[model samples]
Target: MEIIAEFGSSLLIVGCVLGFFMAWGIGSNDVANAMGTSVGAKALTLTGAILVACVFEFAGAYLAGGEVTETIRKGIIDPSLLASTPHYLVYGMLASLLAAGIWLLVASIFGWPVSTTHSIVGAIVGFSAVCIGSESVNWGKVGSIASSWVVSPVLAG
Candidate 1:
């Protein structure tokens, strides 16, 4: 608490910058993936796909991203365990953002499809398990999310 109070402003600034980079990475990687099929099928031109993606992405983020944001923020790890060491949570989140962003950038460059959500979730799980003990993580929630990775595709198909 004391640490957070002392460095709250600086942390907020850093968080904002990292968040921007993460969003940029999502645009470069996930957006391309979302738009690829349409472009490949010639259903939309590259420019048209970009325009459509920009509009829908903004809409989705603004209208439907809240639940996901909350889940990621609180569902993956037990926040009560970090009450005594708030700085660890902040640092972990920052590190996760940096790692996920860099990974998304690299994957985009190589034309590898990746889920931004999975990257961040894996980072959080790794950090919590390593830094705060495996007990701090919500393994059940992680398992459910992991299962969705397989289940969703199968169901879609």
Candidate 2:
């Protein structure tokens, strides 16, 4: 509490910086992946793909990102448990952002296919289980998400 109080502004600043990096990572990896097919098919040039991605990314985020944002913000982890140690939650989130961002950057560089959602969720689950205890995590939600990872593609097929 005291630590957070003393460094609240600093934490917010750091969080914003990390959030920017995470968004950049998403743009580099996920956006590239999305636009790759078009580029490969020669349906669009690299510049065209980038321009299309930039517009649609913003539109998608603004229009449909709320549910996802909510799930990531409050669904996976139970915030009530962190009531006594709010700082831990803050630290965990910061760490998760940094970890996901780095993983995305590396995966993109290697041309590996990856989901940005999975990376961040994995980071959050890991940090919560290790730092805050397993009970702090909502296993049911985690299970649902994990099941979807397998089920969604199969269903699509």
Candidate 3:
């Protein structure tokens, strides 16, 4: 009600909607993948898995989601000169959320095992590159993220 009314700003309103879509897409696909194995192995019934995921997802969102959101807002793109033109950051975020949500939906429909993290990161990078120029992006952070993607599996195996 009031929260909905609070979205009087166009970008904030759209961002809220797109954020919902992204969360729904992520929940439907990524959460299923995370819980599938346990359900398959009979360690958790489908209901049990869903319930567990609901608890943990809510917890994670409440606990760490703010940090992630803050990072996405200010970490990836340098907003040093955005004081006069502050709308681009909102535009970029809206675009990133929509892109990531759409990518997740497409990948899930095609039965592809896509990582939501990667999708969001890629969307942010692409948006930054196109909208703000590649130089505005923090390539060093991107490089670290990419390297972890490569190193994680090697270490896990």
Choose the strongest candidate by TM-score.
1
- lDDT by residue (1-157, candidate 3, tens digit) is 3333544476576878998999988997888789989999999999999999999999998999998777667677787745555566666777889999999999888878888889998898888788769998888877877898999999999
Which regions of candidate 3 are displaced past 4 Å?
1-8, 155-157
**Candidate 2 residue spans exceeding 4 A from truth:** none
Better of 1 and 3 by lDDT: 1
Q: TM-score, each model? A: 0.95, 0.92, 0.86
Q: In candidate 1, what are the lDDT values of residues 48-130, reduced to their tens digit?
A: 99999999999999998998888789999998898888888889999999999989989989999999989999989988999
Query: What's the lDDT of the predicted structure labeled candidate 2?
Result: 0.93
Higher-lDDT candidate of 2 and 3: 2
Model 1 lDDT, full chain set: 0.92
Task: Give the Cα lDDT of each candidate.
Answer: 0.92, 0.93, 0.83
Cα lDDT tens digits, model 2, 1-157, are: 8868899899989999999999999998988888999999999999999999989999999998998889998999997788898888999999999999999999988999899989999999999999878898899999999999999999999
Question: How should the candidates be ordered by TM-score, best one leading?
Answer: 1, 2, 3
Instruction: For each candidate in turn, give its C-alpha RMSD to the true structure in angstroms.
Output: 1.1, 1.5, 3.9
